[model samples]
Target: MKTLSIDIETYSPIDLTRSGVYKYTESPDFQLLLFGYAVDEAEVHVVDLASGRKIPEDVLSALTNPLITKWAFNANFERICLSRYLREHYPDYFTSYGEDVATAKYLDPLGWKCTMVLSASLGLPLSLKAVGQALQLEEQKMEEGTRLIRKFSVPGLQGRVLPKDSPEDWELFKSYNRRDVEVEMEIRKALEPFFVSPNLWDEYRRDQDINDRGILVDRNFVESAMAMGKRAQEEITGRLQQLTGLANPRSPVQMKKWLFSKDHITHTLCKKERAHFIAHTSGDIHEALVLYSQAQKSSLAKYGAMADSACSDGRARGMFQFYGAARSGRWAGRRIQLQNLPRNSMEDLDLARKMVKDWDYEKLSFFYDEVTDVLSQLIRTAFIPRKGYKFIVSDFSAIEARVLSYMAGERWRMEVFAKDGDIYAASASAMFHVPVVKHGIHGDLRQKGKIAELALGYGGGEGALKAMGALDMGLTEEELKPLVTSWRATNPHIVDFWWKIDRAVKEAIENHRIMRVGTLTIFMQKGILFIELPSGRRLSYVGAAMKMGEKGYKTITYMGVGATKKWERIESYGPKFVENIVQAVSRDILCHGMKNLQDRYICGHVHDELIIECPEDTPVYEITETMAQMPDWMPGLVMRADGYETEYYRKE
Candidate 1:
């Protein structure tokens, strides 16, 4: 199939960084300056539309071609910008794919390839310049790009902003846009060998399709939530001013100085963690000061105002991102960040939601300390029941724990799961050697169990415990280490399982052979490898390889290693590989459950939880039982899934 790789220079009145693509392009002040393209990597072409050059007939035809692949770094930018361009230039074609087309039928997200995602897959930096250099492309585009964006971008004056229209500037804009496509093409070529595998490309395609079928949102919930957020925001502002004896106290830098220099909270009030904690706890004075400062940078006071610009129609659309967390293949959120929002604080969510909708700020503020907490919980409330249906939320119970044990062949751990799978409490009891009663009976034990399970799993030690806020949980430093040790010793089979999988993966990568642990197969190819699950999905390693480290033993590392490009490094098979295995197995379990729930229920999922919108009469217990069963091949590894049917998506 023929592909047209294109790039464009555009101007928008909205601040691109904070406002993002939606608001940036949505502005009435948005306009295209130059369009650049290459057809089959032939002679690269530039059309200086600003300088009055007509788009070539072929280029115009390619834009309309259903089969012609359009490529860009953030293809969303190109797709959206070009979409706007097409609708303005050729309305019939644009509207055909827009309001008229049945989204599931003609929406081929495959028509575009986001080189940003491709770069991410190869562990290349996000910027086109960085990606080009990483691929060792002959030409560099960085410095040229910086100057060109400034040269062609609409100039800003005090009261007016206008695009550059000089013929010379137009030529430069064309050149810059051309280089973007050039750099992108070069990166694609360099990574061609890696993408040669059909599975990888197929996965990439499916990811795009998933992005295309972005989730439908509840717009009314969004509006009501925003209204409540605004009212509380104003009250918080007034209270902060009263307490701090300063106007507009939300400034971080100013708040830091005030807290430390005046209030004498801490010397290091400038630090984020310290400042945030102190700011929240300092009551009216500290919060007021912080609120003033925050308003200066960008008003949290204008809480819900941003939502309308961020949201899509009555439904907040395009929330799910395919492979957004590429490392874990976890979906990321675009607008609301549904993945990381705070759990609902109110026990009776429906009542709290009603209060929020009615703009009852005084009641909510009375119960909740900061408006952010209330706002955070209310984000989930945005996901509501469609007219006649209620959301039946089901999730794999102790899924990560179950997957780890099953993959590791830890018979002892599996047996525990088989017999009532409350691994957190079970882990706590096992660690303390005391019988753990159910939640209400064993109150204090629950906290210990929850912390230990959350932190110590996947071979986490002291540092993990600290990350899980063990100290903040009123556990002393001495108790933390011993608790970790006790948990590790109690789950000895799980510890051994980690080592077992590590050895299997290291052997597979080093020997260029396959290693089997139970039903899982670890395969290596040219230092790039993945585990082939019994269900047949191969977990691709980010940077799969083996090398002799400081430990003097050959260690293996997987691909997509780090959270960011800076701190992420290939590390030892001992811990890093354990993390990989645990996550991979967890992903497989989700895939397994997803396959089962595909057509029988609404195929909606969030992290480990699946929200199946069902009728009131539906038997929830049977739903849990069905998810508990495993695939035929994963024998003797007893698993279970349990969750409540909530009117709104929330944790029970």
Candidate 2:
């Protein structure tokens, strides 16, 4: 067979939603219930494995054959599940390829194609049901599948009804399984014209390899942190109860009522509001508010996630989702979200971690006033390097800023980068006509320059400045408008770039003509707007059109997953498109770096940073230098990487 489109139904005692497919399949009770397949758009077939039906020899061989391509929606799940199924059922077929069933990784991703990834590439929904509806497919996935899955697949649901117990539902479940394969095949055919490029497939393979490799987790550290967090929560709750006399001080409504009745503080208990009130209040009120804020830190729950998702080997797999960010095609954190882990700013993280791991709660409390906050900060330390190996954590320095400068042709900014000068200082020097330094002459202006650089690079205004915490940084409301104007005036080229992109998008949609702005190529094709990046990957905007916006001006709009995550027509502008393009390009540059370092043992990556497990002797500078190399497409772009070696993961 040249190609196989497959789907399967599985039953596992493990919680698949809490634990990823790798950990889910590790359960001894995991069973493959139904296997559906179609060979090259031929007749579809279903083997009721749970009903004791056996798959044909030819079909089984095709699964392990590298020459035959495999297609599925969310192919990673199918590939990983089938890998285990084969090892348990037909070991010879799995081992015939010289792979050890006991230690082999999932089936080679090279031979697999994911329809979900294809849909995501076109800015389509990632779910099979959503994609089927989004595409208006004739063979949509069966809605009855969910109820059937709950009845049969899940454990502890009324003694786990079997096929014999519910014959009709079992037959319907088989049909549901068959229909999924049919829908996946239809999706493949519909998306054939916009097939994922070979280079992207290579990148997908790399992502799969990283996920399969997994990251070592310190189980003892995670468990100890969880226990300490529980104790901290109890202590804080008790203190709040004793001071406020509230039955449930943790409840925001109760706390708000208590604050108003006792201290006459009439405001929401948000982080900023709490900080504001804390500064104005005194005595027991201030102490209670501080305790409440410390108790509100929920990041310590990540330790629980790590503990749940870790495999028997003590490694957490499937933490990163490839192409999870539909707009920018960036990887998204899955089970234990490493992307938003609380930053570790403690001076002695090693000592604190050791104390916690040793379960010395008293000592920890003595050193740290807020034990819950400390536990939140220690979440990153839960990911440790393997024995005899150290972590080389490297990431690009100001990747988005550098990319924005290169794309906008901001010469002064680029010059600052080339000379290794501080952009924030250079921006202050350019905007205010003063030589700004980090902690030297005119250093106070550096904060303004820093805020402006962050908020105004994408055509932000006074509102963006406020959202970036300009006021919290001690900038007045009156200064906000002037800062926005000064930043825009100083970087005329970047402002022009925004408008150029805006006009290009409008022209592409209104006139149905191709438009070029800088290194980007925009065009409309079959109701889709495509912006081809310098890396040759096109960002697709579905159902491109122009509409009269709320501001009484014609705005470019397209069908996409909007703020509510529903498929709808959303409005856009020049600066917003610039943000998307800049972020997308930045993601490509990161992928390029990962490609360069593919030979190394890359355990995980979060945004611009890569965590590599290597020998203690590995030179940190070499990894950083290699990651700093620029791609040929962006020749004049200046790039830099900063990294450090650590025994455990942490932010530098």
* Model 1 per-residue lDDT tens digits across residues 162-270: 3344556555566777777788788777767663323344555444433343334555556666666666567666766676655655655556566675545644443
Q: Give the lowest summed-lDDT range of ten residues in model 2.
A: 95-104
**Please, what are the lDDT tens digits per residue for candidate 2 over residues 1-652?**
8999999999998999999999999998999999999988998999999989999999888887877888899999998999899888888777322242313656767677788988898888889998888888999999898889888989754677899998988889989999999999998888887735557888888898888878999999998999999988999999999999999999999999998888566657888989998898899999999999998887888999999989988999988888898878999899799898999999999889999989999999999888887898889999998889999999999999999999999898899999999999999999999889899999999999999989998888999999999999999999999899899999999999999999999899889889999889999987889999999988889888999999998888988888998888899899999999999999999999999998888999999999999999999998999999989988999999999999999998
Which one wins on TM-score? 2
**Whose lDDT is greatest here?**
2
lDDT of model 2 at position 328 = 86
Where model 1 places Cα greater than 4 Å from the true spot, the runs are: 11-33, 49-70, 91-107, 150-155, 158-164, 195-234, 237-265, 269-312, 362-373, 385-392, 440-446, 500-573, 588-605, 610-649
lDDT of prediction 1: 0.63
True-vs-predicted CA distance for residue 578, candidate 2, Å: 0.6
